[model samples]
Target: MSLTKIVPSKPIKLYCSIICPWAARTWIALTQANVEFEYIEIDLKNKPEWFLKEVNPGGKVPTLKYGDDYLIESAVTTEFVADLLPEAKLLPSDPFELAQSRLMADRFMEFVFPAFRKGLYQGDVAGLSAELFDGIEKFEPYLINAKPFFGGSDHPALAEILVAPFVSRLYLAIESGLVDSATSTKLATDPKYAYFNTWAKNLIASPGVVGTFDKTTNLEQIKERLAPK
Candidate 1:
């Protein structure tokens, strides 16, 4: 298949941080769609004046500036980028598949993410690791029928793109001893989790997923965060 080359009126600019999972999702989708844009690194910790002005309402990362038009929120940004390339549709055409796919993303954000997100923030250290394993279990069965991907898709589908960043972080923590070895072990080895494990492997291998992620540095950061001072 020939690549689709778009002639934009001007280059699009993406304001994002490397570590933000939401930002990471947009980055992956953009890459998968073969869309080109200017990447503007934003220090989420220290918001720049220009960034604040650009994303005035949200002051958030993963903001897309196309010509003079601006968009916020990772999901919206991803959808906007997808629209740019009509040939590379991210969501499926089947209504049932689209709804189910969206449902999986919703499950991860509402149920799986919150369960572990607070634990990671609280510096529960151990709890942060444990909560993720619980979330993985919830995801495992759902992925049981997947073809090395979420929703049994043959390719790295939307759900994989959205969740890979967080999973990558946990996988790193496990290797560095920041997370419990047993939990990571279960996530990787448990038969019940075969679906997620295989799909995760594929997601981990995706160029888009790896391009924005820095596991080694992120591990060191998490370790420093949990260190007993």
Candidate 2:
């Protein structure tokens, strides 16, 4: 597997909101790829007409404008950027390894993300936290040999990039007392999750991961959204 340098033919612009985990995924990917681009922050509550009509008909953030072409959805946009900058090695070059990375990300998104969201928004913190732990238990074996990332790379891989945003949010939620302390302790100290704990700590400490995360503001918005209406 060889890496190819990415030379963008046109300017890149990223449409994103810091509060959105999905948008944060694309932001992290762009930074990891070392791609130069303009950042356009969107107000989700008051979405602009131009953004809706032109950028994304669905009015979603994390839209990528590559020259005149626009791409939506965080996963697709992240993969597009990774594919564009093969030299970054964000995604594995080998087909099998790349598929494994994608599979891990898919499983996290399908299992853990929903449970985490339910815990955050629905006030079922304890039950959902247990459910989340169960999901993580299932995911732990995949990381047995993964030193710092699921791709078995020293640096973050596509799987980490996809999941780190939510993990960061979970950290914030725990700090803010939105998630129970028992769950947090288990996640951090349990022998079963030692590998995942290390991977998560490294991911959170990574350059683009924390930089792209606005913990204070994002936590506030999450609380507001989860507040009784």
Candidate 3:
């Protein structure tokens, strides 16, 4: 189903931080959709006082200031953009399909990511590798028919956009030896994950994902934060 793009008369402003995965969700969506909007980079460490006072009271990135209205939370902002720019085909128009796509994304965020963080930050490579493979396996069925993306779209949709950031981070961590090297090898060579690996490779290489991701900086930051004193 084709959706007509609704160009808002009011100016759109996105406040984001490059290192933040949540902020990356909105950034990737907007960039992929080719929507024109003002980009406001935020220093998460020392967020501007005005931002705290005038924008999101919680002082988080990925905040959307649309005209005089404000929107918070990554998922909300990403879906809102997808809705506003239907021409971008950011999401599926069919209700059931859209719901299914969202369900996949929700499951990844709720169950998969926490497991990833536990292994990455807590020095649990064995557990992390096992849990990651298990989590990744669950999503394989979703991509069983994917032609390199969710819903068989040529390009990414909302579901891919939502999870790209975390996937990028985790893959990077794995390649950098933060996770077990064997896990990365399995992702490439294992027949069990063939579908997922294909989709993940395409996602990481996609323009919206690669252009917005600063790999060198993020890896360094992760190393520094997780470095033992």
Candidate 4:
């Protein structure tokens, strides 16, 4: 299947919250693609009237406005930006590889995050380790041959763009003792996870991930969100 490229006739604008990992995914994609887009920060707690009325009634961050039209959903917008700028090579050129990248990213979004949330909010360390280890193990195979990134891309690709936010938070969570220290040790030192560690380290340091994510602020916001309400 040929990759379809959509170049916008009008300027692009993205409304996102800095603390939102979902929004971070789209931000990374557009930034990595080197697209010139207006960055409009949304106050998620109190959304603007027009944003609620016209942009997205659902009031979700990462709402992308391409001229007069709008697109919501982080995953949709992330991939859309990659597809829009084919020259960036954000998605793989090969069909199967492209599918694999999307599949891995989707898996992370579906299983990994929910597991992390369940563990964090419920304070289930054992359950957290078990679920996280399982999810990480599943992700291992994809990176076994990675040259520090999915599909051996020198820069972050679609998979990295999608999963980087959560992975970065996972590391921070571990360092902050929110996640099990043993789990972090194993991920860092265990030979079984060497490939994943390499890929993760590289992903964290990549320009796109680094540019869009602020470790300290995001960690604090996450803790605040997870605090007893």
Candidate 5:
């Protein structure tokens, strides 16, 4: 799909942190849309006063400044950018397909991610990993058509953009031994999850997805954050 270049009247700036999945979502959307914008990295641990009071009162990363308007929330930011660049076709034109894409993203956030977080941070890694696998099972059938991405689109769709960051994190966790090996194996080799496994591999390798991903740094940060107190 061809992306339409948007020449903004004012400067566009994105406030983000490399380690933040939410920020990654917006970054991927912007990159996929081929939008030119300034990226400003934020230190989540020690956010500056201006960021807290002015940029985003809630002090969240992935805040977008379009001209003088500030936009918060990753999903909203991603959608806004996609809508702004219609020629990108980041989202499907068909209403049913678009709703399906949104539903898929919603499912990952609601079900898969919480399980991943619990497995990573709360202990019982084995049990939680199983739960995570179960959550993944819910979406495996969606990829049964041999499409490289969700919804059978050759290009990364809205669903892929929203979920790829977390999916990449899951791979990092598996490789780092934070998640159980058995769970990882099931995701990789089991027939039930074969489609999802293939989809994940392609998504991770996509330029927009990998461009914003720093696996080494992200893995180390995850290890640090999940370490025992």
Candidate 6:
């Protein structure tokens, strides 16, 4: 391996918060890509002065600093890292394949991201059925034969990395009883998403998605945030 590929003298610095779904994208991408980065956990409640001033003026987690380059935004950072480390093959190599995969991933974000966050942020069961089912309905037919992951295969794909963080959170909430059993039962029984639910159960049990998740505390924080005024 070339020195540039193998060794980054100054480790790529990642400023992130554990709770952020956006930050989790970069985290999963980095792991699957096998890149070495120095992580600086930023306290979202009380962001460091340096993090606020230098890393991200917008005060968001998932700010990437490689050498002098400061990259922000989860999608840009994940894709950029994938492209940079072609050996890892985290993204598609062929041009046509690349375009199609990117399109699907974009669609996943539209349905998956909003629905997951809606349920999580609300911390109530009232709209949970609609939120969970809508995302699955949109994503299921497209994943008719996902082998062991998104699209098809045993290993996780880009869309999985892009969407799994929030899925992980929803599972956490359900397991902790923060979300009602009705919501979980509705998800499991939704005809539009039977396969999707099957896939979700597998994913929630997977190491990559589940390992990064903190079910108990994360739910506590969300509950606190969503509590009535």
Error of 2 at 147 (Å): 0.9
Clashes per candidate, residues 3 or more apart or on different chains: 1, 0, 0, 0, 0, 0
The residue-by-residue lDDT of candidate 5 on 22-63, one tens digit each, is 899989888877778899999998999989888898989899
Worst 10 residues of 5 by lDDT: 137-146
Clashing pairs in 4: none
Structural similarity to truth (TM-score) of each candidate: 0.86, 0.90, 0.91, 0.88, 0.91, 0.85
Candidate 1 lDDT over 163-228, as tens digits, reads 777666655666666666786677678797666666667777776777678776666667666676
Q: Candidate 4, overall lDDT?
A: 0.79
Candidate 3: clashing pairs of residues: none
Off by over 4 Å in 1: 1-10, 55-57
How far in Å is the alpha carbon of 210 misplaced in model 5?
0.4
- Tell me how far the alpha carbon of residue 35 in candidate 1 is from the true structure, in angstroms, after superposition: 1.0
Among the numbered candidates, top lDDT falls to 3
* Prediction RMSDs, each to the true structure: 2.6, 3.1, 3.1, 4.1, 2.2, 3.3
Model 2, global lDDT: 0.80
- Model 4, 93-141: lDDT tens per residue? 8898888877777777666776567655565556767887677777665
Instruction: Give me candidate 3's TM-score against the actual structure.
Output: 0.91
In candidate 4, stretches whose alpha carbon ends up further than 4 angstroms from where it belongs are 1-8, 120-126
List pairs with backbone clashes in candidate 2: none
Worst 10 residues of 2 by lDDT: 1-10
Error of 3 at 148 (Å): 1.3
